[model samples]
Target: MKVLLASPRGFCAGVNMAIDSLEIALKAFGPPLYVYHEIVHNKYVVTHFREKGVEFVDHLEEVPHGATLLFSAHGVSPEVREAARERNLTAIDATCPLVTKVHLEAIKYARQGYTIFLIGHEGHDEVVGTMGEAPEAIVLVETPEDVAGLTVADETKLAYLTQTTLSVDDANRIISRLKERFPQIASPPKDDICYATQNRQEAVALLCSEANLVLVLGSQNSSNSQRLAELARERGVAAHLIDGAGDIEAQWLDGVETVLVTAGASAPEVVVEECLDFLRDHYGAEVEVRTTREEHVSFPLPKELRAVSVE
Candidate 1:
């Protein structure tokens, strides 16, 4: 069996920064470091951190006063930040810069008296956070169908923004529908889909052509990872979205000779390695990495973490 691995897979710059921030915080503050959510969506990553005494909380009130709270890379609503402040918590934002870009666009369009249409899943952490920026003026659209029924008080004064980790093809289809319906609708100067997501999906689409089955390594709740699997399946290829090797089933590999392996931006590399190792042991697979694009993006640690300590 041959394994075709996709390039630009696994952790993205934002996930790297968020994970690194947690490690740095742990080093500086010791055990019992609290995180607002799973620093990223990967269960392995969160479980690893939990073993190191990192506490993950869903509600700000669950966090004690005066505790150091780190926001997840998925970003949070302004209300969440305010709640942190209300509890006297020292908050560190690990939200990805790409996600922050969407928030800024929502605010900008809302400030300009334009009703904003946010293209994203309704309940996603990133979508929720971006919508919170201008809740009064923003409307959530999950699919192209949603765009068709969309109505605004001022059609000419409408704008659209998108979540960073959405399916590129789906987002474009939705955007095209929006444009067709409202010829005067405005969009961001640049697309909101992040480079990491675009490149990874493009790579998987390319890899699926030659592979009999595509194994996407990502958490079930991970948007980008789920999109990768969906993209492959859309091409009539057999695809599976597994968190790690343990989830892989022997029956799924029957008649499958070439397998394409890829991971989500928030997924850890170790999970990919484990999956590859499992295939190699079970099927004596030979591996090859198919390059679609090279990535060099890097985000700096939080400013608070960089401050020099007083002697």
Candidate 2:
């Protein structure tokens, strides 16, 4: 078997910032630190942090008053921020700047009395956070079919924004439908899908062309990770989304000739390495590293934590 490892895969800039912020926080504030959600959507990352004494919580009620709390990379709505403030919790926002851009756009559209359409999956942490920005003005639009039934008070006063981690092709398809239905719908200066998401997907699509099987390393709840596997299956290639190498089934390798391995933005490269080791020891897989694109993007830690010494 031959292994094709993907480039521009795993731990994008936003994930880097979020993870680093937590590490710095841990050093300065110590364990028992509370995070609003899973720091990033990787089971290993969350479990690693959990074992280190970081407490991941879903609600403000789960955190004690005045405790230091860091928001997840998937940005939070003003309401969540306000609630944190109400409890006097020292909140350090680790929201990706790209996601923050969408929230700001939502606020701007809502303030302008424009009905906003957000293209994202329902119940996703980022979607939920973005929706909380202007629940009254923002309507969640999941599919092109959903666009058909959408009603607006005034089509003239309409705008559309998207979740940063959405599949690029999917978002484009939905946007096309929105434009056809509401010609006047305003769009952001640039598409909201983050560079890392688009780059990883592009890499996967390129490598998927030659591989008999594609393996995506990511947690189930990860939006970007799910899209990678779905994109492969959509391309007529067999793919599986697994948290790590342990999830790989022996039957999956039955007739596989070439395999493509990649990781989601939140996944760590160590997990990717472990997977490669497994493939080599068991199948004697020959490995080739390929690059579809080069990524140099980076993000700085939250300002409040700058003073907190980071190792």
Candidate 3:
């Protein structure tokens, strides 16, 4: 069996920064560090941090008063920030810059009286946070079909923003439909889908063309990871999204001589290594890494973490 690994997979700049921030926070603050949500949507990452005394909470009220609270990479709304402040919590914002950009755009469009159309899944953490930015102004649309049912106060004052983790092709299709309906709709200065998401999806699409089955190493709730699997399946290739090698089923390998292995942006390379090792040990698979693009993007650690001196 041959295993083709997708390059530009696994951790992106945002995930790297968020993970680093948490580690730095833990090192500086010690045990009982509280994170607003999973720093990144990988089971292994959350589990590792939890073992190291990190507590992931869905609500700000869950955190102890005056405790250090780190926001997840999926940026939170202003209301969350206010809640942290209300409790006197030492809040560290670990939101990915790209997601923050979308939030800012949502706020801007709302202030300008534009009815914002947020292109994303309804319950995604990122989408939830973004929608909270301007709840009254932003409307969630999941697909191109959802675009038709949208009710905006004024067609001329329509603007669109997207979840960073959405499929590039899917977003483009939705954007095309939005344009067809509202020709004068405003858009962000650049595409809202982050470069990392676009790069990883493009790599997976390319890898799927040569491989019969694609194994995506990512948590089920991970939006980008789910998109990767969907993209491959849409291309008529068998794709499975697994958290790690343990989730891999023997049945998935049947009649599959060449398997493409890739990971979501939030997934760590360590998880991917485990999957590769399993494939090597079980199937004697020869691995080849296929590179689609070179990425050197990096975001700096949060200011509070940077202020801490190394011991």
Tens digit of lDDT per residue, candidate 3, span 1-311? 99999998999999999999999888888979999888999999999999999999998889989999999999998899999999999999889989988999998999989999999999889999999999999888889999888877789999999999999999999999999999999999999999999999999888798998999999999999999999999999999999999999999999889999999998999899999999999999999989999999999777777887355
TM-score attained by model 2? 0.98
What's the C-alpha lDDT at position 7 in model 3? Answer: 96
Q: Any residue pairs clashing in model 1, and if so which?
A: none
Q: What are the lDDT figures for the candidates, one per model? A: 0.91, 0.94, 0.93
Cα TM-score of candidate 1: 0.98
Better by lDDT, candidate 3 or 2? 2
Per-residue accuracy of model 1 over 124-234 as CA lDDT, tens digit each:
989989988989999999999887688789998999999999999999999999999999999898889999999999998777999999999998899999999999999
Whose lDDT is greatest here? Answer: 2
RMSD of 2: 1.0
Expressed as tens digits, the lDDT of each residue in 1-311 for candidate 2 is: 99999998999999999999998898888979999989999999999999989999999999999999999999888899999999999999999989999999999999999999999999999999999989999999999899999999899999999998899999999999999999999999888999999999999988899999999999999999999999999999999999889999999999899999999999999999999999999999999999999999998788888777543
Clashes of each: 0, 0, 0
